[model samples]
Target: MEETLHWQPAATHTELLAGPVAEAVRALADDDVHVAAIDPGLADTAAFCEKYGVALDESANCVIVAGKRGGEVRYAACMVLATMRADVNGVIRKRLDVRKSSFAPMAEAVELTGMEYGGITPLGLPADWPILVDSNVASHNRVVIGSGVRRSKLAVSGALLAGLKGAEVLDLATGA
Candidate 1:
């Protein structure tokens, strides 16, 4: 699912991105992506949308999940529309092939991803980690996602996100 989207220069909001995220944005050099700074305190999707005048339907949430197998923990990031929630115990656990899966602790998510708790994005995730994008999310023309920090958000084409390495767009979301 691909659609044309309007994007601008992400470099304009470099100050809002975390170190790794900023570097990743520069590396991509996507003219079809843009970043905008906002109050870190309002980084949460609902607040960010309300405060910044962005529609909730156009905002995506990146949630880190911890899957355990034989005492070893593996992580995956799930991207879904703010209007829905990921099917973690069902679709995700099955996809990950793990015994069980749960949302990663805030500390662990931030530490491992080198991003803020309320601002984790799929863009700069570890290469080994999978980025599960819900089908509906992949079909959106444009979406607002975290910038690896709470102070900013990235506006990008849904097709661009689905194209990221290790990204798998599937039916991973359910009604909230």
Candidate 2:
């Protein structure tokens, strides 16, 4: 077994970790995904990568999304490079068959997905939510994703992330 990280809790850890990101990482019970709790509350992916020497391309971000459509409102758990932006207009709308797609409000992002706005990941998304991943992300053998809280992150296999419940492998983001 890989050495699991013993993370020191952040001030907001208890409140946020108990939500979506936690569920997502926990869902990897049968897989090799590992969630590491860290205390760098303000560290962006680039900073994290520089500090830990993690490659930016290999560090993925799980973005909790909600599409408020005309008749088909929906949610999605998307994974992309920490440096790139998700193609919300092109990829998400086409797939969801919705008139519009936008990032969910902070309250909704937290309440519905059980995750904080700055900290969301596919691992802990609702089982019915769709998961869209950038094709580049899928090419990596392993990647790191945010935990429900800003203090933690999950490292997982890119090829297998979509196999988890409610995950859909799609080209949903732009280049890194």
Candidate 3:
């Protein structure tokens, strides 16, 4: 866990999390998963890392992407280290079997995931959404990620995240 934030069992700090995130944490019941409060104003990845003295590689970002084919839409979440970028147009598009893919619109992402923009995490996404985790992120011992709210973050092992339902570990990222 990052030293700048006070870490505690995520199961014990549901109040700091968004509704779906809290529910997910309780359901997970994993003691190793932790949470920490932070300044909501610094929720964006770069700002959060710089203000808290955490390295970009020690944090992960969850991105919502929408793929469309034949007028139908498929949505997925891609998890990648902050130092990398999800290959939405290539990897994700092919994975979703869609003709094209791109980052989901902020309004649609927030509404669909029931999370705030800049603070959405894969933990509490819609059950139907596939979670694509970058290989580098899935190999980390611990990484900070959103708690579905701008005011807090979750600390979890990559193994735990990889074990999540609908999670698929793959080469989903490109160099930043």
The most accurate candidate by lDDT is 3
Question: Per-residue alpha-carbon lDDT of model 3 for 56-175, expressed as tens digits?
Answer: 999999999998889989999999999999998888999999998999999999999999998999998999999999989999999999999999999999998898999999999999
Q: List, residue by residue over 1-176, the lDDT tens digit for candidate 1.
A: 22222344886567778888888787888887797767778888887788777778899999999898888898899999999999999999998889999999999999999998899999888989999999888999999999898877889888988998899998999998
How big is the positional error of residue 21 in model 3, measured in Å on the Cα after superposition?
A: 0.6
Q: Give the root-mean-square deviation of each candidate in angstroms.
A: 4.6, 5.1, 1.8
Q: State the RMSD for candidate 1.
A: 4.6
lDDT of each: 0.87, 0.68, 0.93
lDDT of model 2 at residue 162? 62
Give the candidates in order of lDDT, highest first. 3, 1, 2
- Looking at candidate 3, what is the lDDT of residue 158? 91
Q: Could you tell which candidate, 1 or 3, scores higher by lDDT?
A: 3
Question: How does each model score on TM-score?
Answer: 0.92, 0.79, 0.97
